[model samples]
Target chain A: MTVQQNVAQATPTINLPTINLQGNHACALGAVAAGCRFYAGYPITPSSEVAERLAKELPKVGGVFLQMEDEIASIAATLGASMGGVKAMTATSGPGFSLKQENLGYGMKAEIPCVVVNVMRGGPSTGMPTRPAQGDLMQARWGTHGDHPVVALTPGSVEEIYQQTARAFALSEKLRIPVIVLFDESLGHLEETITLPDVTEYENTIRKWATGKPEDYKPYKADADGVPPMARPGDGYRVHTTGLIVAEGGFPTQKADVVAPVMKRLLDKIEINNDLVESFEDIDCQDAEVVVVALGIVGRSAKKAVRELRQQGIKAGLFRPITLWPFPTKSFRALTKKAKYFVVAEMNAGQLILEIGAAKVDKQSVSGLNRYDGEPISPSLIKQAVKEVLGHE
Target chain B: MTTSNKKNLEMRFSGAGGQGLQLCAKIFSKALIGEGYHVSMSQSYEPTSRGGLSRADIVASGDTPDYPLTTELDVLLILDQAAVNASEGIIRDDATVIIDPRRTKNPPQGNFKVIALPLSETAIKLGSERITNVVATGVIAALSHDIPLDIVEGALKSISPKKFLALNMDALHAGVELARGLKTA
Candidate 1:
């Protein structure tokens, strides 16, 4: 609740006993604090520090850190570890994220709980490995093949990176699905001084495990929360998991009536628990004429630009979505109701802008300021873009 | 030459890869954090191992900055020509720029005070060229009033490898002497 309250305030809170910590290092520490016991990853630029720190830290906590052959094996081993009743995760950048898509999709269908971190970098394929970019916005949502559920959190600061990585584990365990922690390379590598939450006081969320008779156990069956209890390995329950559509009995099914409800439950679970999935930050959105929407580092830039614009008598505000996937549409609409125009600023060449356009209400104008040249969008650029949007009006 | 409030002060350490540019920023960050100032450090580099442009920037403030990356630099350290062009159009008019004349062919032409020091040469004379980053870190800390030399030395001792501690200390002191000479001249 303290972390959520800090994010809702949307201002950096400086507490005492602060240590200057890098974002990737914070994420690894966060995972350990969240009770993550297994890490399988191949080191990649921008995200390599996450694995590097985990390699050094995980063993101290009695966790297993594996250097896999490649990215695909990394996610597979992570999912396998989670299935063995351990909190597990794997981290990568763009190209490695591409290789893990198949196993990520498999984890989704099999209802395995795990965390996947993709520190965004410039890319169609290995594009500027060390440079920062937010080109993976849409890919994170639709990279896998099919209509699978996604819950991705984008934290904008080093402190938030630590908090959100822990939250990713909690959400994954609660929902029985893979959760992605998305942040740009700038945030991944940026170091800041802040107080981390005490690991002793932190509560770790454990996935629901099956307890009833093994004879009546159905691994694919949904409870009231639309999440079925997973059978722990070596339990007396007959559990079956596959990528194919399955019935409540946990066997493959092609019957329309059986497949329809199964698919519906898979997708509808996210919608049904939107309250748990939706999170965003609203800064000066009330009575504003223009709202700037961004995430990660661009969101931080927009925060500064919006404050400067307010001092200049411009009604500019920032609406940044910390929960990037599922887009947090309801809160975005509710918070920016007074805005007449919206500007979506991102490091990519217009991916999140499309989602913002789709979420707008009637008569609300939306524009985009896109950058894909491996440079971050600065505060001045966002201010200029907001002025241009207002100038046309 | 004068120490000011650490809030909102932007500093950059830039050069080719393998020059330990990020380490320079890390030392400053540790020193500042010890003084109770919040610091945010970010880096940019090419994919190569040792020859492309690399930079690490720090923004120190009373609280966490709204934007962490540098927009206007108060102090700039340039060790190679490859890093010169990347810093153009962003240096403050009153910024202090320290450059190695031996490595940089054409440094930026600006109103900022450009202090051309034999940074690399001084490190080589001390022991090895690899300690050039520690030497440059000392120059920036010595010139800036907000950072105390004792704190910087403490940070260096904590972060340096055990075998190189004495060499690094010598390089740091030589850098302080270089800046002291500039002030007296």
Candidate 2:
């Protein structure tokens, strides 16, 4: 279905009160609605508003909000909370995201279910704090180190930010992995009037809890879905969790034979359950000559540009991945089968385009429209690039 | 650059930082939301505590806009010269632009209608120069066909802090008078 139809179906027909909500604020609310009871974060630009809003909203719901000393401690605290059997989250920008990598890696290796929000900003260091950039597209998937299961979502609008933030928590809990929600500073700060979904209507997905004999339980043992039931803190199940590779007994082991299946199960969980983990939006791609691939704010710009191009009788389409990590390759190829040319428009200097090139089935002509000076890619820029690629006036 | 049939009205409240440009846009956004129109507000500013280019834009439509950011402006409010160049090449031909002559030395020169008003001067006369944003908000509300004066006043009343309610109301009224005077002349 088209993006417009998806939006129409998502909006409830009932008369719901609409309010102007910033994207960051929507994330905080979404987390609260998703039954996230613990938040640990260090405030940074573009992403600070998420913590700020949660500081006010969490207390009302009897949730714990922490202003940790640093980003590392922030993620560490968030992981600890989740291990204690609570849905937890922490938000940060580029510099802090770099600092939290080690703890984020720990969360991944230990299979701690938590949500990490990274509001993309211009960076290698503390580079342009207030400006927006998509430079972290590759880093988000690989920053935590090793061959680990990664789930990162990219939301384009404020409404999608809310929906995806909730989805991040659900996915993290269900799969027992750290789910990252990535959006640039532009979408983080943008406010729009939207009727938020009723929190009561959300079916919060709680993690599978350990049952039966406490002595017989093993922490790393996998079910048919490859996800092991987590032992609750007070449930008397003797559980051992660590950052090192471990066997089904949850004991650290370096023996290659024993570690092999343990590692494979960790990676196979996401791949086997791809149905629940993948989401994307395709707009007018059925009979198009050029298909533009983008996400986040750049995706919204491409959507507008594609609409304008179609008005001028240009057969242009847009394929936007709501789930950034894992790339949604299977669906992308299936949706854009007839397209001859592809353009990847992003705020950074060619990060996601690399994945697009690798994911394409044929040797279709692929080009990029990249802007890294911290300004967002506008619709006019995308339209001009599409025209140039198509050799049109 | 073709306009769609959708009533997508775009407006910008721009000036140097600490001028409450965001508050101006928020008040209008609240008013538009109350009128059953969907509003998308986005802002851009420097990383300083104060005194840099700051702008807040609002795009209102009957339905959620496909793109929320402002590409072509229908109305523009410039409180400082720092924000003048930011609107270049994007102002629509039939747009209404209001500027503070005391703060902006050279505004954009175009086919759009430019009304130079004493926005900051009016706020100074009231009490503080910080309320220049409120004054500008009033002028925009008065000149805009989509927003009514009473609804804008109600929004200002609801959003303004209790301590500054009376001053903000006075500033808003003075702004409406300035726009009305321009219309009469």
Candidate 3:
């Protein structure tokens, strides 16, 4: 969710945590909003509603919805159709999302633009059918093996869920990369009153094409912004995409010279597009002695807890990363100068903590308030951890 | 700034799932927000979908209310016994507790005042089980005196569909009437 501090509006907006549309149907509408023409998600807990809704809604706009053989085919088919010059996506929970990792990496490697919605469930293996967790935040970044780039956004409201889904696809297509829209089980099943905006940006976004003369076009030719124009198979641009390292124009080559820059470009696109790829919300952290870092649904709990601590005259703040990858280093690094204590509160034992450790270790006191029993990490525990880290307890 | 009596009012509504209690909570919060006050709402429920502990707590003040206040509430609306018994100990001295007498036999403990009204039973008599939340909302409107009946009625149609909308509207009227009768008594 975008938190715009509108000083000029001057209406004294209430402190109510703004309401958003729920997660599952939000995914369906997001896909539609992002101009996705193909969806193939298998039924899974906390995420099945998305598939169920898309099955009913996809046809009205002439999009395709299929129940593929498995999660692998689910992504592969979506990727293939997306390469055919249509925006595509797949939705799944933990197990299925885990299953799609192999193809997900392939899609990243091939620079195939698409969106994947992981309606996260509590899991090492199907831990809970209807619960919320942030364990997968790290996994969403590193689940696929090898050097990969990821764009992830967590929605704390039903409205953000709907809008983020669309935004994820737009980023995927515009940057020619895959994006993971993270919504856990609790969010997927949540029912709320969401005001659907009549005007939205999803209607206008990048549409990959089979452009230029079929005979003269080099399929991988970099455009001014560095993304090469992609052409479909039957477009006669004579292009090929593979999981293996391929040379320029997508041909199998042994020379390092041919394969190196494709990898560089794939990684570079995420950097060039970092501003658009990232999203977050900040609380009163200025002059805060203790700053708590969190993501996904647990982030909401952090916001609540911070408010309570501040009331007691405790200088506690919440630093949340909406875009997990291309980590919010600038903000965190700057924060360490002012903040003395840092706490990482996520659902897993200590997954996202490693990143905080990487960002800054000796700079401040770092700790984790982790929960893995299929329950949400409450704010009181985080506040207690903050107090202890601050030497108040 | 003139602090209306609503500035100090905080409320908790508890009921079973499928009873539309959460929707009612949101509508009441929206109505209060329309009055230009601070409002925050949160709901807790299990996965059962039919019979479960579903509750929505709304905190409103001239300024922001402290984090999901748990110590003592200014007002408590309980649709069942579990709510009153669960929260009976925490309400502040002189705070008001409203319960659906049909659901709970035990009176509230502590220094808090208690009002046992069969709002749900009255709502059932008015025609449907769905209107129970709307009636409970009216009981709240009476106790807090923060939200207007017109605002709550408008919120009903805005949230529910056309088919069930009229029933909830009448349910709101019946709720306001019952509160008025209690006020005179």
Q: What CAPRI grade goes to candidate 2? A: medium
For each candidate, what is chain B's TM-score? 0.96, 0.96, 0.86
Per residue, candidate 3 scores C-alpha lDDT tens digits across A276-352 of: 66666667765778888887667767877887888899988877776777687766676556788788898888977
Best by lDDT: 2
Question: On lDDT, who's better, 1 or 3?
Answer: 1
Tens-place lDDT digits, model 3, residues B1-185: 12555455566777666767777778877777677666655556655777666676666666444233334577777777656555655577877778788876776777666787778888889887667888877777765656777777666668878887778777777777777888899
Ten residues in sequence with the least summed lDDT for candidate 2 chain B = B1-10
A36-138 per-residue lDDT for model 2 (tens digits): 9999999999899999999999999999999999999999999999999999999999999999988888988899999999999998799999999999999
Listed for every candidate in order, the interface RMSD values in angstroms are 0.6, 0.7, 5.5
Clashing pairs in 1: B3-B145
Ranking by DockQ: 1, 2, 3
Candidate 1 vs candidate 2: which has greater lDDT?
2
Fnat for each model: 0.95, 0.72, 0.05
> Weakest 10 consecutive residues, lDDT, candidate 3 chain A?
A1-10
The estimated TM-scores of all candidates read: 0.95, 0.96, 0.78
For candidate 2, lDDT tens digit of each residue in B54-101? 999999888888788999999999999999999998999999999999
| lDDT tens digits, residue span A1-393, model 1 | 001221322223455346788999999988998889899999999899999999999999899999999999999999999999999999999899999999999999999999999999999898989889999989899999999999999999998888888878888998999999999999999988778854432234788999989999988888989999999999888887788899999999999999999999999888887887788878888678999999999999998898889889999988889989888887778878999999999998899999988898767988989999999999999999999989943
Q: Is candidate 1 or candidate 2 better by TM-score?
A: 2
lDDT, model 3: 0.73
